[model samples]
Target: MSTGYDYSWFILTQSIIKKEFALSGSEQNPDLTGKSWRMTLRRATNKGAPAPVEAFKSHGVDFIVRDRIEDLVAEMNKLAGNDLLKLEHIRMQIEARDREIVNPYVKDAQVMNIHNARRYIGDRLIRTAAPHRILDPAQGPLIAVKLNILTRKTLGGFETDLDSRVFGGEGSIIPGLYAVGEAAGFGGGGVHGYRSLEGTFLGGCLFSGRNAGRAAAKAVG
Candidate 1:
């Protein structure tokens, strides 16, 4: 319940937000990495929030990122004020594909587990002649962000900061607060954390969701 996130975490997020955020420019389409899209209103959003970059269009069906939808709706609704579109209507608008500038998917993970600091994230401050530290899409492809995450010690029988299993032991004590997929350490065999992986979040969500449903059913019974 009380996962103690320290002040450093706040500072880190602020620093990261500043570095990661971009100011959207008109005449240019936003292209989020995944099917995600979030844009400022046709009026006043300057921060370059990621948006879907049109290439996702295929025949009629298309993918939409949930994060983008939430963000775009919030921004537009801010402009709409009391006239905010109904959630259903908004859904209709979404299905209608109303966004102009958009981005695809984005990095949803709060952290990345690396094998070594210099090799993986790399020496950000001296990455290039341009004087770099993470890659920015605006700077072109091959974007990279060399992060130096805290290397917390793993004592085992608990969740590691990297969301890894430090050792095989009696797992989490969420108290019938079920967990599955990566939460319960799926496919992470032997390693303490995930060195590199993607889409685990979605898979984890599905696994956990199904369990929650089953638990609910059992409780009801």
Candidate 2:
């Protein structure tokens, strides 16, 4: 989802139309068969990753390391249990993206964005990595991580007022019931609308909790 392309990692999604993996079973007993994403990064890039090198190796089934692109592709395909990705296609894409890194005034949107982000002191020092060719032998020992899509949070919940009181079926306040934070739909059900901004949920949660606590204290007093 992040398109900043800071050259930290190369993300590739499986062809949705070309494949139809199983998705049967209940939420608690759900099946996760044949679902994976290919995320490749060079040795230098991996060093900058939040997790340490040992963590990736310990990640069983989801982690892969290879010194060569050809071998990397082969392992990736073997992991997927099918020939979903072609070595040539993957090589060409990486090569094209790498070519844009050499040009300071490159027209590539992703590369340009990465450059722009690196302009910030904080990003340059920690978050963003300097542009580099992903396939460069100097940055050898390519790493591939098989990622899975999972829901971490919900953006929708019960409609509530400023005081965090839940609304009844007829839109009136329901006494003795207060839904705050995410339960009250993240900032009283209207602050974020349909799509909420990332990293802003904590503020919403605190605000809603403060209001709910204050209102509850007043009601009891």
Candidate 3:
């Protein structure tokens, strides 16, 4: 399943990895699941991400850690079994992005998005890192991850009537049976268009579930 956020080009620094990368899953985040604000605050301001993130960096096959970009690209190419990425090309992009931060009115969209996200007090304090050059050594060793595509949403499934009654093979409603969420195509799959934004599947799932629940309750009454 997709993690819902794209980190394909995300370059993590050794110093910020702990604070920047929070591994997915409930068990990976004791601070959050346990509702310990004090621990959470520590993680936010801390130099490291969570323990699980560190473990992945140390042992995960997809992770490439290097002191230099050239070496990093070499490892990446080796891992991918091809020389598709060029060191110079990647460096140029990093340099160009780094130059944008010098001006407050930079035209870079991604940088602008980061700035906008950090405008909120909460994001500024705990989420968004202060803008910095990627090549800066003070941030520590650079890290690249070979992100893999994950399948999550099922675009279409069993057909259903407006009330979420499942349609049988002969185009008839199956009595006392219903479907919802992804099974019902997320409210006929119209809540989100052809392409959905990151982390938006939940909205469709919740909406369809609510509709099915209401319909089932009404039928019973």
Candidate 4:
């Protein structure tokens, strides 16, 4: 949204890939093209992400809503000067979503400023704590983060032209042409700008596949 947050991952990885592989960044900065990271592939392409510090705002993302759910009720009841109970719950929610997807600011202790913990673990939710934030077994269940983490991955390994190619120009290929998902190459690989979708490779496949299918049918007929 804003801008100024400098992303090191994109800058570092790209540098390594090119310095070692002799590969090009897009086509323009074929030289320092190594300065971008796979993660920034989206923002670098998006009309938004101008800089990092400015783009990285608050922590807005999807997470588990924790009210209280435990797999072991009995285990939760057995702890008392003894190691018996082990029940837990985890969930939290936030107002920002889109911003979190691209640039998520990981909080410390992960406990937000509201005394409540927010999680972006695949889904959003309120991970509640014990009364007065005691974190006691008797007070309530302890909400924790799920194993699966939710994050926005960048697009790369392929190159897409944005100049004469037009935005999403390859969206629909002509008959006889076939596209192989990411197999194509750097998407929106231009000197100045690019556009990219999250994980909708099927769109590209369908467009190219359809063209091939039609071409095959005509040849057979």
Candidate 5:
């Protein structure tokens, strides 16, 4: 769903349950449920390789590389063990996006966002890629990264007081019970309130931990 310079590109599949994830085997298999794959396709370059790509490579994560789009699509299908992604469908989408890039006025939200991000000097210099067609021969050979989603943190948690004391169902603090950091819901249960800015949770965790430590120390004293 997001794209950046050589370092960042993310695409989240739209439907949680789709035909792409359905395996040929029995539906009774527990492992088959809720399984899906996300892929990032980018132009291969010697320079400006994304840090994650390097790290992943060093850690032995497999990467698909091909000189031709057809070859790339074939590899992707081979890896997925399914013919979910059609070469023509992928080509059509890429060509459509490329066409918008050449247009003086673009209506694509993602392309517009990319342009908007580049207006900032920092993003322009390091975080955003120059708008280009992925199919451009000069940009090949292409790289495909298969991604897996991992749960990092919870946005919501136990409701707590400023001192990190856990609040009960009746809205009373439970004796000798406390929650801190993410357990205190990042910042007492509604600090993020359904959404949060990246890296802000660290601050909330630290602040809540500090409050809990002080409060516990004072109470014990």
Candidate 6:
């Protein structure tokens, strides 16, 4: 839902979601819920977003599918029952973002982040898409979604270390106890440091969970 305007939302192409869209809940992601790594990997490398995302595009109330930006904006404005969005304004912003794809070292922070993500073996294999222009016809027909808030995870909480041991105000590890997952602030009380990004929460939780289990096991042994 980021298009550089507080009042405006983003219009993602079919290509964008394939790498980024991951629906939460058991019913939403069968592979994930079933704990099948093979199926989950296949889903990631699949031609499009998971089944649930496609279902949303086809049936969700907030979604609008269109081949042209003009038509997409028109439908979006109509859905909101307001003229607050302008075609020219939206086009200008999209064009600007698309322009960043050409740079080897892009100035656009989001685009740069996309490139950064692709550098990781796991992310490159399935998580992030290669840098490409948003308006590129090959990646379209455009998909505009009227996004609604769905809380997937919390931001920050109790601080901990690599072993998931809670830290006291005096910066010492509190003994005989451990924290992990969301309880460890999704890893060391905000793994992203000063600036957190989307999709990092689960990874933090998994990492801390392992550390906590290992530490607690050794402590008892």
Index of the highest-lDDT prediction: 6
Every candidate's lDDT: 0.32, 0.63, 0.77, 0.30, 0.61, 0.78
Which lDDT tens digits does candidate 5 get at residues 43-151?
Answer: 1222424333344333534456666878878877787677877889888987887799777799888889978988986556444666767677665556665665455
Off by over 4 Å in 2: 1-61, 187-189, 192-195
TM-score of each: 0.24, 0.65, 0.73, 0.24, 0.68, 0.62
Off by over 4 Å in 5: 1-46, 50-52, 57-63, 187-189, 192-194
Sort order, lDDT high to low: 6, 3, 2, 5, 1, 4
Q: How many times do residue backbones clash in model 4? A: 43
lDDT of 4 by residue, 1-221 (tens): 13432211110112111111221124333223556554334433332222331122112121121234443233223322244323331211221321332233535333343233224321122122111332223322222221223333334433323211212446643433333334443232221125554334446545544554565666668
User: Whose TM-score is higher: candidate 2's or candidate 6's?
Assistant: 2
Candidate 3 residue runs with Cα over 4 Å from true position = 1-10, 15-20, 23-27, 162-165, 174-180, 187-221
Clashing pairs in 5: 1-10, 1-11
Report the error of model 2 at residue 188, Å: 8.8
lDDT of 2 by residue, 112-182 (tens): 99889889875664446567777776654566666665655667788888788899999999998998887
Candidate 6 lDDT for residue 156: 67
For model 3 the local lDDT of residue 189 reads: 45
Model 4 CA lDDT for position 191: 16
Clashes within 3 Å, all models in order: 17, 0, 4, 43, 2, 0
Error of 5 at 149 (Å): 3.8
For model 6, how does the per-residue alpha-carbon lDDT over 169-208 read when each residue is reduced to its tens digit? Answer: 8999889778777766883336866455655667878888
- Top candidate, metric TM-score: 3
